[model samples]
Target chain A: MNNNEKDKKSLIDDYKLHITILFISTISLGIGTINIPLINGFNLVLLPIMYSLFLAVLFYIYKPAKWINKSQSKTCAEILLILISPLIVKLAIASGENIDILFNVGPALLLKELGTVGTVIIGLPIALLLGFKREAIGMTSSICREPQLAVLIDKYGFDSDEVKGFFVVYLIGIVLGTIFISILTNILCYLVPLHPYSYALASGIGSTSMNVAAVSSLIALYPALSDKLLALSGLSNMISVVFSIYVYIFISLPLTEKLYEKFHKYFN
Target chain B: MEIDLSFKMVSEWIGILLIFSVMAAIGNYVGYQYPFVESLIGMFILCLISLVGLIVEKLLPFDNIPAIIYISLIGLFVALPWFPLADLIIYYTSKVDLISLTTVLLAYAGVAMGKDLGSFKKVGLRGIIVTFAVIFGTYLGSAVIAHIALAYTGMI
Candidate 1:
């Protein structure tokens, strides 16, 4: 092919990539627009984020035709990081709007984060009992988001069993975590006696989508406090994102490692 | 050493963000019933803020910090009372719904997940079981603690 033909072909491929993403994204949003009501104003809302994720996964895995190749998929991953910046800005602005309210509840927000250790205390035992060995340390260390994944990778390298464990939890966290937390928050809202505000703070366990899903579920239950709950969730999420790496490196990782050494023999 | 960034690279980044903003504006209009023009304007401002954040990440001498930190700080700076455009920024941006933005980001996240699915299946049933435990532990643990703290503070 001549130079002109090659240039034209590449240009078409570029537009194809953009067009495909835009097409699928718009459809997911369209589907997400539908809000089906469940019993008594508690709507069964599978968020657009959830549907979009599942749609893309299914499209890539099941399609007979190779619409999106490996290189394009890699490009999509790179763009994901850039795309998240605007969302981060939105949450930050939300925090700014409610900074005064959040400041008033500073102690609660600060103290609630300590509960993240529950993952190790509760999850470590279960993971160990499942005969996971050292993998239990990585799996139970944190929620296994990208930040925690980075910690494990930095210390143990990307190919370690720890990272394998990290990927397991990370995959689960993204795919089903939102739906799981949404239902759990709804159930806890009725079963547990905690105030709605506590639920709001609790909903912010670092992952933005899961936090939104959980908080929105709680908001559906208590519409009157929607604004307050959202603000609190945003602040809680920000704190979790900012401080979680330190917590993982200094506290969770070390603690899980020590515990894994002690408990591995018993499980085996 | 000279910065290695090129005009082509920066323009590509900006172009992607603009397309994303357009999708978000449409989503905001359809889902939240927000005005399309207002949402578009709001998202444009947000795109600019995100661009600044990305640039700051490049310019900073230090490494390891996530760009979200800079983005959040910029958002807060513009929204805070001290900023001259705080109210205007807040008003227009609020018109753009948060969930709509997630839809766009996660679409990309989903597309990215295509390659990882093969490895994902290898995780086995045990990994899935432990995953549930870890996720539940974090959410429940945080909620319980926040509950106790709220009770102790008499803020409940």
Candidate 2:
């Protein structure tokens, strides 16, 4: 995976397929932009990202035309980071313009990260209760997004139970996390009555799609607060992107290991 | 040997980013009603910053830091008030909506997922249940804390 041999080969051979994927993505952008108006002036904002994603999936899974092969999909996964760079840049620029938003949010930005501990506090216990072994630590220590998965794989080789556990949650995150978070964000926004800023901060749970979904929902609800919300969410996500690994390694992983020793017995 | 590989890699990245900017600009115009030319220009500048960040990541002795950090910092630096092109950068970039870029990223993500459907189907019910717990715990937990923190800070 580290070597660029496969990447280079795909770049050369599958250049046409890559363009086709981009073409399909453009169509998705058009369809995804549709927003249906519901009662009480609320818009049922259909997720454009969802459509693009599902379309790509259909192209892959449809038997008649196997549009993308394993190598090509692998290539797409590798370039995911590169594709995300522009969005990250956009977020950073948002943060720069609203530097005062950072100051205004103050310790909330730092303290809200503590909420990540909720992953272990809630997820680990349930995972253990469900009879997972050391795997619970891998699954629950963090959200197990790409970066956390990389860290876990480094600590425990890819063959380990921990990694198996990591992949379980990771795949679920990739497949369903965005949809779940978007729905949850909207429900919370409607029911909780919390400030849009808090929702924006919550949206930065260290995964790109999940974070994007959360913030998109917030912006849909609070168009007037779009800039500040984007700024806060971007900064919060940047904090997660930069610091999530250290938190997982130094704080979450170690603490989960300790708690596992004590909690595993009870679950059994 | 490494330098040659990286050079080739940069060109490939440019190709990919070019595809994203051009398509995303069209999407921005169609979906959000942003000006196509302005959005295209904005996306190109973003691609340039990302390229610079990738180069910096390769040049650095330490490998721990991700390119996103450098890319974001470069983005932030140029957007700072005193920077010469801050306004221009801010103006065009504002035309390129964040959500529009996400549609492209996730589309690729979905394509990547298609290859893994066989393995994805094998995940056990326990794992699925716990996946929900992890996602919910992280999001709602953070939201609750942010709620309290915001009230205390009087920002709400």
Candidate 3:
């Protein structure tokens, strides 16, 4: 390669990742802005995404070296979630008088056989069919998230055999689940005929970061449903947290074992 | 990574405080109810509570409790109208603008994914497929049940 060409390629090699991130964020922000109208004689609607897009460019350009690792990214994500936690609090507090919604919403979420419970019911059979071993079944069925880990440790002690699979799934959930859930839910919104409330409820799959990402996209599509969606998501999340303890103790743990005994042979 | 109990850490903290101050000042012009001065105080309170929550979370005899839930539950109670300074907290937090939060967050997520491309590739095609398959089944199960209930209740 010529000297000038070599210099250009070297610069690209040095900073390609940041450039790629900036490009992706910019394109996504641009695509998201397509149908935005000039609300109040100005495009105020695009401001948030634009600001976010700007932050992306600025951060990529500056490159926060401290935040380049997996753990640091997770910490930053936790901090961001903390900043956004008030939304949940506000929604819960706003829906305080209408505690009826909790009664009304709780059954739908719990009964649907989804969330953590449904994760096992639906995912176990499929994972088994896919030749998944019993070792991974514990992790595969449940969300294998933070709360589950805590419960697992408390119930069986940290040294229990189940803890091994939970840790693997937990790692996968952190690294892949956090990002994929957002993208997947958005795609599901388009695929399913259900209302945004259902999507919001689904968003509350017991992971705060994923829930935020899912609800954000859903809200973008149906801005009018923001409050209801947020309320349902928050309430559902609260229910998940409060009841997940019982669900695991009574349902998920046993079911995983039963399903494994019944199906692990088929996989082999 | 052991955080040094030294002047450097102190200096870093001071720098972060200043950045939040500037961000809040700019937030005033960009959004509603997020007053420049109020935002500074608001962010300070958020950081303080989060720090406390982290300590409490670490001391708790459990694993895998994300600090977000700890702080959110606590923040929820603190945000009740009956709580002192609740109105001020609402005024500041309500202006956080979810869209803005999402944009910045998802952007971070996107970049994190980009940075982790090597590891993702290592997980190979099977990992990606299983992840999607699990997610798909979960959504289908949830949506199917939620749809029936909503239909029965006529909330659809």
Candidate 4:
């Protein structure tokens, strides 16, 4: 390949690495957000924003040359920031109290709480729906990029009729799965007396990132359960990550390929 | 007086939609390229949407005031009914939360996106059937495994 082409490829690789790092950071923040106290009703919503902003700042400052550069500087910087931001915010509040600023801010707390409730109820779902759809589109685009997977999709011979059929089956599977898991978790919770928070944690194992959001929001609303929720979520997240890896490597891809070969004629 | 829906809300929603779409598209692509990134990508997409909503609200016209109002409303709705639904099911049944359910749904999406039917190939029917089967089977397997584990440990 020409030098220009090589340079372009390298740049793309770097971009991919940055994207991956950003992706992982977002997931981690989601995990962290679940445990944040819901003082004045702040929870998953604000916590993630705080964490992501920290990440963005770090990204901007370090501007790592490679994706996997394990520089302690960046890690230390992040740790310091996470520790400091809350302390600063808390200190400010304390100082405000001494100066009588607390009184002025105190009433605003009610407004903030009301506002939080409103946003959580009305805005989050719309965001989630749009988010999921967008993620779906993102998934589609990503799939198109993979030669092997793309070839497999093309071989499946997607058509309007087939797409509709697939959509139906897909929806059915989702509904059934949801019902089944819900029942199963319910039974477990009843017998074990697992807290609702614990149930959320376990449920999160299937999808770490999504679960992080669920767990964080729950923690934010109910700070009393924060520690237990965090522990459970952490455990569940580890298990989910392991399981996800296993499924992807051993089951999902191979079975998909095999099935594709076996049933190609049926789809057409 | 009724509060007007500010440009911030509209922008936030649109930003959310765009981010989500990007995430979804990226996820689909990444799953095809590296299946391992599936759940990670899925979560990232969700986070990006939320972030977009939060950021755009700050940057755009509605400012923090209307944005906060919009977000708080959304958060409450999601947490309230959804949490209870999961709780109610767990209250009476042996199952847990909806993780497995969502996973199966995602897996189906992954599979549908992953498959490649040759020209003149009949993937439509087969893909549908297989996707359903896979989702159901995975859900059942996960639930059984979780239930059995909990039972064995005397947790359930």
Best prediction by TM-score: 1
DockQ, per model, reads 0.47, 0.46, 0.25, 0.03
iRMS of each prediction: 4.4, 3.8, 9.1, 21.2
lDDT for each residue of candidate 3 in A1-268, tens digit (9 for 90 to 100): 0123322222123233333433444454444433233322111123344444345534544566434454433333322333333323333333332344556554677655444556666666665665546435555656765445544544444334455445445445545664576567657777765777777776776655556656666777788988998888776665554445446656777777787787777677
Pairwise TM-score winner, candidates 3 and 4: 3
Clashing residue pairs, backbone N/CA/C < 3 A, model 3: none
Q: B42-143, model 2: which lDDT tens digit per residue?
A: 999999998898788777765566666687679888898888999999999999977678777766766766666775566678878999999988887788
Question: Residue-wise lDDT of candidate 2 within A237-264, one digit each (tens)?
Answer: 8667655655776788888889999879
Residue-level lDDT of model 4, residues A1-268, one tens digit each, is: 0123222222222334334433634343334333443443433232232343334434434554343333322222222211211111111222222333223323221111111122122222332233222112112111111111212222232223323333333333332333333344434445655445434444443333334544555555467978876765565543443223223323343444343345434433
Number of backbone collisions per candidate, in order?
A: 0, 0, 0, 76
The parts of candidate 3 lying over 4 Å away from their true place are A1-106, A109-116, A124-268, B1-41, B58-69, B105-115, B122-128, B147-156
Docking class of 3: acceptable
Q: Using Cα atoms with residue i matched to residue i, what is each candidate's TM-score against the true structure?
A: 0.74, 0.72, 0.50, 0.28
Ranked by DockQ from best down, the candidates are 1, 2, 3, 4
Candidate 1 similarity to native, TM-score:
0.74
Displacement of residue A223 (Cα, Å) in model 4 is 11
Candidate No. with top DockQ: 1
Place model 4 in a CAPRI quality band.
incorrect
Candidate 4 lDDT, B69-95, residue by residue in tens: 233223323223334442332222111
Which consecutive 10 residues in model 3 chain A have the weakest lDDT in total?
A1-10
